[model samples]
Target: MEERSNYVLRDNNDIGTVQIADDVVAMIASLAVRDIEGVEACAGNMAGELMDKVGIKNARKGAKIDIFENRVKVDVFVNIAYGYNIPVTCGKVQDKVKTTIENMTGLTVTDVNVRVVAVSMPNNK
Candidate 1:
């Protein structure tokens, strides 16, 4: 991967620096979270799946990435299985996201915020 120059916004002044892109971090986090057990799905918006199918290759709409001086913050919207423990599952999601993003991008993960938007019951048709 090519290194992109980073920019800092300081009191309306632009400072050039080098950092990992937010999209790359988000995608790594999202995929890592999805790999954990008890996670029914990784996305909360329709556009997310559409983008995935269309080869957009990054988390959009429902995923937010905050870049900081020494760390990164990620927020993921998810749907959980009906019988899963909400707290446990969410915690696992947070852990996996943080570990993956940090390991892959070499950036410290300060926080991982998970929003459970819905629960999906098992289909018994």
Candidate 2:
């Protein structure tokens, strides 16, 4: 047996091994959220927000992904557009992220936790 760290091994055959990184999983979640209608933006965690202040931007800003024995858990912070139903938007985000990750990575997504950090005001100009 071999010891694995960040990446999860999806398959191993005579040719080679296929692995998916945690960062990659986070990126997938972020993208899935982006496509949802009412998502204003993906808000980063405290550390990631601090990094932004200093001119460093995290590519995968809002999504936090954890993998354990081929199972994945995701936490995504988001800003929703004003007047949109919060529960509906969050539910859409949850469903999309879970389906996308499972389809793409072949790993089971145990749960997707959505945190509504802020709501963007609709512009009337």
Candidate 1, superposed: residue stretches over 4 Å from native = 1-19, 45-62
lDDT of 1 at 53: 71
lDDT, each prediction: 0.71, 0.80
Best by the lDDT measure: 2
Superposed on all Cα atoms, the candidates' RMSDs to the truth, in angstroms, are: 7.3, 5.2
List, residue by residue over 57-87, the lDDT tens digit for candidate 2: 3323678777888999898878899989999
Per-candidate clashes come to: 1, 0
Please give, for residues 57-79, the per-residue lDDT of candidate 1 as tens digits: 34454466777774787888777
Model 1 per-residue lDDT at 32: 83
In Å, residue 80's CA in model 1 sits off its true spot by 0.4
Question: What global local distance difference test value does model 2 have?
Answer: 0.80
The pairs that clash in candidate 2 are: none
